[model samples]
Target: MATFNLKTVAALLFLILSGCATYQTKVNDARNAIASENPEQAVALLKPLAEEESRDQLVYLLDYATALQQARKFKESAQAYQKAAQIAEVQDYYSVSKITASLVLTEEMAQYKGDDYEKVLINAMNAVNYLEMGNLDEALVEVKQLNLKLYKYRTEAKKNYEQNPYAYYLGAMIWEAQRSFDDAYIAYKNVYDIDPNYGPIKADLLRSARLAQRPDELSKWQKQFGESAPSVDLKNSGEVVLIFEQGWGPRKESRPENRRFPQLKPVYARTQRAKLEVANQSATTNEIFSVERVAIKTLNDDYARLVGSRVAGIGAKAVLADQVRQKNELLGAVAWIALNATDRADVRQWSTLPESFQIARMTLKPGKYKVKAIGLDAYGSESGEQMPEREIEVRAGKKVFVSWRSVR
Candidate 1:
């Protein structure tokens, strides 16, 4: 056998460690493209990157699909999301090589499986995309899959996990549209169970109860709120629900509490929410959920295990370096530097996500109307940012879904 060349090995390790880091520059380019309202450019940048079945696959897939969705290519977005959902189904099931690297070095060296919440959002986002494409059937399918995923997560985690209220709400709406009032009532009830405080939850519940002939539920709500359900003559009225995406979701950074594993960094969102105007009536959005908050909680949940694994890995590398030091001091020093140089918290996250999800709902008589969406501040004042005026035709007894996004 040939003699081991420590110098050559050390030099090669240095190069490998340095080169194995993420494509931060490319990711930033795609982010900049989306922020500048140029999603096509973002798509071009991430198209090839997403094809690599390596550590960055999930991140790139998410960014690419998000860009496609932002560009209003609903069909394309749905396809991309479908591909992502398949990968997410097998959460944390990376290849043997990825597992070895993660164990020997850092989790950052492994394929990014995404936070649990992010995995769930894959289907939730797809459900909405299906809604925009006016394919209620597919939307329902995605919702069912999303529900199944959440069920599995809760069972595995052995506790309650977050449920997407918007998904449930949309499912209810779709069921009602299909005249499946009984199913619609249950779906709406799920949304209420998750968040009864949601501004429109009661109104929706009341409507669903009357439609489904749930007299007891209707009376209970009426007594509690001391008000009847807002009369929406479903036979003649039309409804619209707006899903608003505002600012950017939280990012991860090293924090004092646990520097070994990153913490959720605060997002400085300029626009807090959005305001919608239609048919001489308007409603300001309310925060349904904070993606950033969920992100922080998930990070904390995984903190202890990750920090312990990282410490053990570093300790093993130190011992190896010490053993090598007895043979060649220079090579040992280089090897130590190379290994520790790449030691960092796995901060990669789905940066394209919105800071929070907000919603606005309205019911109007069937007609043609011009709709406008304006960004707002914390105090219910306009932020001087708005989507272009859009005209929507509402048919009698039908519902519509509209989505607006702002990168504040």
Candidate 2:
């Protein structure tokens, strides 16, 4: 009996360690492909690992969806993210009985119930993808779904602090595009309520207020911001908006401790914004804007809140292990030591996500324009890699949208 038990434990440990090693190698390889600007290769490499049967399904699905979006496969990207969102919703109702497994197994062995912020962002990405594909109806549906999810979260948290300003900003854009000025005004007001100093929010608030004919609100904002508020000539003019995303987001890794289970920590890299320049190809209209992006959902805050629950579970596991050791010294000691070494926290994340999302909205005549974005470090030194200069055409009385990502 002792021999069989020992062998079982050995097999379980080997399986856990080997599986993590194998998955981590694949993750690194896909990251390399993305760094090389070969999103097609990244998608191919991540697809197999993103299967429903995989242990890290949620993490890989997010990676695969991002790669697809980078490749401009917006429809496919939306579908992939939709799958991840479905999985997240299903896990919401997962039974409390699953806690029993924590006595013997770490969080790494359980199915991933995605972080709340991740769930909301998944829908936001889907909405953006639909808009990119020129499906306004689908995009509106996704925006509504995002609102529903946000409301659900707010209700569950029993506080209003968890509201997402970016999501509200996006909702305002969709509504404004549809000429639903009242709805757009409400959404923009929500953003302003959350962050009054946000660059684009002030401009959006002004536009919506003007369209909705709320002179009182418009006067209030105009008085508050004066000439510093971002504005555009909406009458008899077209606009080009650039939604820029900066370097890679946070990643997850385990920090091991003596005689205690490893803890998962989010690792963020140091990155700086690059100077961006825009010019008109048809005429001499040059513009420059400094990079300014705010955190809509802070991962550090999420991790800080999660630590309490994790500590409780881990503490209970330690107590149980010590009790087992009291009964059989040698076996219990071996088991306790083994769990200490092998039981690690799950360290998977949406590795390709951007650290921040920013907007550069400009009003221009109906003509072609060229824009370039460069990467910079904290010391204001250039990284020598400039995003390919993009040429965009603006139509009369219509909006032009462009997006660029820098992950250095």
Q: In angstroms, give how far residue 246 of model 2 lies from its true place.
A: 1.1
- lDDT at 131 for candidate 1? 78
At residue 173, what lDDT does model 2 achieve?
A: 73
**Residue 197, model 2, lDDT:** 70
Instruction: lDDT for model 1, please.
Output: 0.80
TM-score to native of every candidate shown: 0.93, 0.82
Q: Model 1, range 1-408, lDDT digits (tens) per residue?
A: 114655567565775657555555558888888888888999999999888777688788988898898898889988988888777667557678766566555667777777788888888778778878888899899888878878888887675587878678778888987789999999988988898888877887888899889899999989987889767587788877788888888877656765457877777866898988997899888787778888888888887888788878788678877887677887778767766666667778888888888888788888898988999988778877787788898877777778887886
* Runs of candidate 2 exceeding 4 Å displacement: 1-6, 12-16, 19-25, 91-99, 157-161, 227-235, 256-271, 274-329, 376-382
lDDT of each: 0.80, 0.66
Q: Give the Cα RMSD of candidate 2.
A: 4.6
Pull out the clashing pairs in model 2.
Answer: none
Per residue, candidate 2 scores C-alpha lDDT tens digits across 250-363 of: 555555453122333333434455455666322111112111221224444555545665676667667767776776677666666666555565565666777666666666
Cα lDDT of candidate 2 equals 0.66
Q: Which runs of model 1 end up more than 4 angstroms from their true locations? A: 1-13, 16-24, 157-160, 256-259
